[model samples]
Target: MIELRNVSKRFADLVVLDGVDFSVRKGETVALLGPSGVGKSVLLKHINGLIHPDKGEVWVDGQNLTRLKRKELARLRSRIGYVFQYGALFDSMTVEDNIKLGITDEASAADETYSRKRALQCLELVNLDPVVAEKYPAELSGGMKKRVGIARAIAGQPTYLLWDEPTSGLDPVNADIIDSLVEKLDDELGVTSVVVTHDVRGAFRVADRIAMLMDGRIRAMGSPAELRASTDAAVQEFLERDLTIPVHH
Candidate 1:
C-alpha cells in the first residue's frame, strides 16, 4: 500500500499541497482529479520520488521514498512504471525497443530470452500485432504509441503504475478503450494505479475513487457517487453541466 501523512509541498511562496494525508491500498485504482494548476500532477511525482515534499513522508509498501538515496531511488523507480502524458516513447527506437526498455539493466542476464517473451506478451495484451514490434514510434498511430508505452511500463511487471493523462486527446471511443485497458491492467495484473487527469470534468467517467484537489489541498475525495452528492461549491462547480454554454463565452 501507498501512504502519505501530513504531506506539504511548496515552491518558494507557492504551496502545491498542504498537510495532505491519504493511502492507496494494493490493487486499487485512484483517480487524481482537479482543475488546472491544482498540483494533481505534482502529487503523482511525489509518489515516485520525482518530487519530494518539504514536510512529511511518502511510503510505498513500507519503503520510505523521501529518505532514499539517489541510487536507491532509481532502483525503486524501476519497480514502478510511469506513463507520461504523451506516451514519451523514444522516437529513434522501434516498438520492440520501447517495450524492452524496462528490461534494460537485466537484458544482458541469463533471463534475456524470458524477458523478450514477456515484453511481446504485454504487446499482445494491448491487442497490438507482434509485428508492430519492429516498427518505429512514428510509424504507429497515437493509440498504438500509447499501447506501446503501456507495454513498456509493464515490461518488468511493475507493482505500481502511474498514468498521467492516459486519455487527454483521444476520442470518446479511444478514451473508453484506454480506461478499460487501465482497469484490465489493475485487475488482471494486480498492479496499483494512480491516474492524474482533467478529462473527468467533462465525461464523469473517472476511476473507482476520485480525489479533487484545490487550493493546495484535497478539497473533496470519495467514490464518484459520493462526489456527485457533494454540495461543496468547488466540487459542484467542476462537475457542473453547461452543454448550452458557448466556448467563446
Candidate 2:
C-alpha cells in the first residue's frame, strides 16, 4: 500500500501540497485528477521520494520514505516503476537499450540474455512489435514512444506503477488505446497503480477510483460513479469543463 498522511510541500512561498492525505491500496488503480499546475505531479513524486514533504509522512509497502537512507530509498524505488509525462526517452538510445535501463537488479541486468528476454517481454506487454526494439525514439510515433516509456518502466517487474499523464499528447483514439493498455496491464500484472492525469474521461475509463486534487489538497475522492455524482461544486465544475460542453452565447 501507498499512504500519505497529512503530507505538505512548498517551493519557496508557493504551497504545492497542503495537509494532503491519500492512499492507494494494493492491486488497485487510482487516478489523481487535477488541472495543470495544481500539484498532481508533485504528489506522485512524493511516493518515490523524488521530492520530500515538508511535513507528514509518506509510506509505501509499510516503509516510511522520509526516513529511508539513500541506498534504502534507491532499493525501494526499484520496486515502484514511474512513467513520466513526456516518455523521457534518451534520444541517442535504441528502444531496447532504453527499456533495459529500468532494470535495477544488478545481476539480472548484467546478464545480457536475461535482459534481452525481459526487454522483449515488456515490449510485448505494451503492445509494441519486437522489431521496434532497434529503432530510436525519433523514429517512433508519439503513441509508440509512450508505449516504449511504459515498457521501460515495467522492465524491472515492479510491484507498483506510477503514471504521469500517460495520454497527455495523444489524439482521442490514441488516448483510448493507452487507457486500455493501462487497464490491461493492471489486470494482467495486478500491480498497484497511481495515475496522475487531468483527462477526466480517460481517468474514468482506466481507474478503479479517482481522487481530485485542487488548491493544494484532495478536493474529493471515490469511485468513478461516485465522483460523477459528487455534489461538490469544484468537482462538478472540473468534470463539466473537461467534458468540453458546447458553449452557446
Candidate 3:
C-alpha cells in the first residue's frame, strides 16, 4: 500500500500541495482528480520517491520514502511502474528494445532467445502484434505507442503502477481502449494502480475511487457516485467544471 501523511510541497512562491493526505491500498485503483495545476502529478511523484515532500512523509509498503537515501530510493522505485503522458519511448529503438529496457538482467539476458521471447510476450499483453516488435516508436500510432509504453511499464511486473494522465492525447475511442486496458491490468494481474487525471469522465469510468485535489489539499476522496453527490461546492464545481463561479484564492 501507498500512504501520504500531511505531505506538503512548494515551488518557490507557490505552494502546490499543502498538508495533503491520501492512500492507495493493495489491489485498489485510485484516481487523483483535480484541475491541471492542483499538484496531481506531484502527488504521483511522491509515491515513487521522484520528489520528496517539503514536510511530512510518503510511505510505500511501510517504507518512509523521505527517510530513505538515494540508493534506497532507487530500490523502492524499481518495484513501481510508471506510464507517462507522452509515452516516452526511444524513437531510435524498436518496440521490443523499449520493453526490454525494463527487464532485469539475468532474467532478460539469460540468453538471446529467452530475452527476445520475454519481450515479445510483454508486447502481446498490450494486444500488439509481434511483428511490430521490430518497429520504432515513430512508426506506431499515438495509441499504439501508448500501448507499447504500457507494455514496457509492465515488462518487469511491478507491484505498483502509476499512470500520469493515460488518456490525455487520445480520441474518445482510443481513450476508452486505454481505460479498459488499465482496468484489465488491475483485475487480471492484480497490480495496484494510482492514476492522476484531470479528465473527470475518464476517471469516473476507470477509477475504483477518486481523490479530488484543490488548493493544495485533498478536498474529497470517495467512490464515483459518492463524489458526484457531494455537497461541497469545491467538489461540485470541479466535477461540473464550473468556470463561471470563481473560487477564492
Candidate 4:
C-alpha cells in the first residue's frame, strides 16, 4: 500500500501539490488523472522517494519513505518499478542491455546467463518478440520503445509500478494498445499500479478507481461510473472536455 498524508510541494514560488492526500491499496490499479503539467508526475515520484514533500509523510508498505535512510530507501525502491513518460531508453544501449539494467539484485545481475534470460523474459511479458531485444532504440517505432521501457521497469518483478503518461505521444490506435497492455500487465503480474495520464478513456478502461488532480489538489476520486455522475462542476467540465475525443471501442 502507498499513502501520502497532506503532502505539499513547490518550485521556487510556484506551488504544485498543496495539501494533497492520496493512497493506493495493495493489488489495485489506480489512475491519477490531470491535465499536463499539473504535478501528477511529481506526486508519482514521491511514492519512490524521488521527490520529497515539504510537510507530509509518504508511506509505502508500512514504511515511511521520508524517514528511511539512503540504503534503506534503495532497498525499498528495488521493489518498485517506474516507467518514465519519454521511454527513457538509452539511445546508445541495445534493448536487452536496457532491460538488464532493471535487474536490481547484485547477485542475479552479476550472473551473465541470468541477466540474459531475464531480459528475454521481460520482453516477452511486454508482448514484444525476443528478436527485438537485439535491436537498438533507434531501430524501433514509438510504440515499441514504450514497450521496451515497460519491459525494463518490470525486469525486477516489482510489487509496485508507477507509470507516467505511458501513452502520451502515441496515436489513438497505439494508445488503445498500450491501455490494453496496462490491463493485461496488472492482471498477469498482480502488481499494484499508479498510472498518471490525461487520457480519460484509457483511465476509465484500465483503472479500478480514478483520482483527478486540479488546482494542486485532488478535486474528485471514485469509480468510473461515480466520476461520470459526480456533482462537482470541475470534474464535469474536465471530463466533458476530454471525453469529446472519440474513444475507439
Model 1 scores worst on lDDT over the 10 consecutive residues at: 240-249
In model 1, state the lDDT of residue 33. 81
Model 2, residue 129: C-alpha shift (Å): 1.2
Number of backbone collisions per candidate: 0, 0, 0, 0
Candidate 2 lDDT by residue in tens digits, 1-249: 999999999999999999999999999999999999999999999999999999999999999999999999999999999999989999999999999999989999999999999999999999999999999999999999999999999999899999999999899899989998998998898899999999888888888899999999999999988888899998999998765643111
Candidate 3 contains a number of clashing pairs equal to 0
For residue 214, model 2's alpha carbon misses the true position, in angstroms, by: 0.6
Off by over 4 Å in 2: 243-249
Q: How would the candidate models be sorted by TM-score, starting from the highest?
A: 4, 2, 3, 1
In model 4, where do residues sit more than 4 Å from their true spots?
244-249
- Give lDDT per model, in order: 0.81, 0.94, 0.86, 0.93
TM-score of each: 0.89, 0.96, 0.92, 0.96
lDDT of 3 by residue, 103-188 (tens): 65445555678778878988888888999998999989999988998988888778899999998889989988898888888788
> Which pairs of residues collide in candidate 3?
none
Give a tens-digit lDDT track for model 4, residues 71-129: 99999999999999989999999999999999999899999999999999999888899
Per residue, candidate 1 scores C-alpha lDDT tens digits across 1-249 of 888888899999998899888778888788888877888888889999989999999998789999999998888888799888788999998888788886635653237687678778989988899999889999988888888888888887789999888888888787778877887787898888888888764324536677888888788888777877899987888766522342210
Cα-lDDT of candidate 3: 0.86
When sorted by lDDT, best at the front, the candidate numbers are 2, 4, 3, 1
